[model samples]
Target: MRVLAFLDGTLADPDQAHLRVDDLSVLRGDGVFETILVTDGRPRELGPHLDRLARSAAMLDLPEPDRAAWERVVQLVIDNWSGGSEIALKLVYTRGVEGDPNATPTAFALGMEIDEKVKRARAEGIAAVTLERGIGTDLMERAPWLLLGAKSLSYAVNMAAVREAARRGASDVIFTATDGSVLEGPTSAVILVRGRTLYTPPPTIGILPGTTQGDVFRAAERAGWQTVVESFPASELTSADAVFLASSVRKVTRVHTLDGQPLADSTELHAELAKVYDSQYD
Candidate 1:
């Protein structure tokens, strides 16, 4: 469904907007972005999403969006959204229109409806394949200036990884490194249950520091479930009692299989966690 676009402050129709594809955000993926869920016309975890949006923009050396105005834009989009049970509100700030690296920055905020099938996947669990895709420690060894943790606009690689996983008959990819250390997912956060302890990779290891996962941890604590963030190899995942991917839109979804091996269902915990997450937005 189509929604209005808010660039800096001006509003325009996305279908007729004049956003340049070759802008710095497109050419170099030099931008920071956030995807917040809109539930019943209200944006979920807006404060944290804006917090990270600014943080990510700072990391990429891009100008931050005006936080107060950005929030209003999201609400406006929710109000204008067409067939929305819920929608994904996205705000993007880029080091502007294609030019020298020192050019001015451009930014935009809009809402996109969450795909219905993806929403359905939350009810029915998702299958995943492990992709040996880790953000290497040596940024200088690769592109030092690129925003590693920033939700930069360069999604080609991430899309490719998801496609690779889909090729293996899985819905998504759980990334790992050459050394077997498990990382986050192509788009979602990786969450695994190790019997009593719930484990996720720490942000120190080049993860996006998931805001939704952060809430889940707090909720788990309230639910009397143990939560921990530590680094471990993907090999450890095979032995995990259950696995799932978490995100604002999907909420919390079970991972039934990893590389063809079945993972025990964590339906009970998923339900418990869902209630906690759903309550936050409500």
Candidate 2:
């Protein structure tokens, strides 16, 4: 099942929700968005997602989103949701019609069921390959206009990387910077386990800061594990005790194989980590 709501506190049929043909979002992918995981009709970490949405909009020189208004839309979707246990609630804000100075922005919220494939990944783990991101680690610092950390709608390159991974017989990808530093997955954050510590690349290296990663780290810390934010080369992944990808919808999934090489079985560790992650809802 799916539900749709507009930013103006109005509900709409998903099939009827439409945008102008010349909208910047359609013309040039000019906008920002966030996907929040809704469990039992409640959105998780909603505030952080909205904050990131505004941050991304600002990065694109778009007006800051009206939080209260957006929140109302989210509530509308939740109220109308008749789905199962989980839903991927997406909030989208776009630059409106092209060449229309009087045009206002387009915004909406969509709630859809989580795909079975995503659930399978969470349960059975995934195989991933490392792909070159074609940008130096310092590019974001040198050029702020690149919008490296923003979750904008411009995802053609990211999708292409995923397709490349599929072509390589992998289900996912771990993007590596031109300088050989590990960045993140196209739709998730990378976490490496070594000893009793968890390591993830810092946001300064041009990756979307993972909200789920932050939650997992906090959970891990409370469970007597150490978490660090630092950048390491792709080679470090091969030597790590275990590797996982963290995202809002998927939460966390073990990387069973990387570049066709099998990784250590961390089933016991994965369960413990998953336990802490689930404890947040309690």
**Model 2, backbone clash pairs (residues 3+ apart or across chains), number:** 0
lDDT of 1: 0.78
lDDT of 2 by residue, 67-160 (tens): 9999999989999998888989999999988999997889999999999999999999999999999988887778989999999999999899
Candidate 1 TM-score, C-alpha based: 0.91
Model 1 lDDT tens row, 1-282? 767666555667778846678787767777778888787887778888899888887777667668887877777777677766788888878787775667667766777788877877888888889987645644422664655667778888999998888789988888886567788886788888876678898866676788888878787777678998987888887778778788888878888888988877777767767787677556
Sequence-dependent TM-score of model 2 = 0.98
Q: Which one wins on lDDT? A: 2
Best by TM-score: 2
Error at 36, model 1, angstroms:
0.9
Per-candidate RMSD, Å: 2.4, 0.9
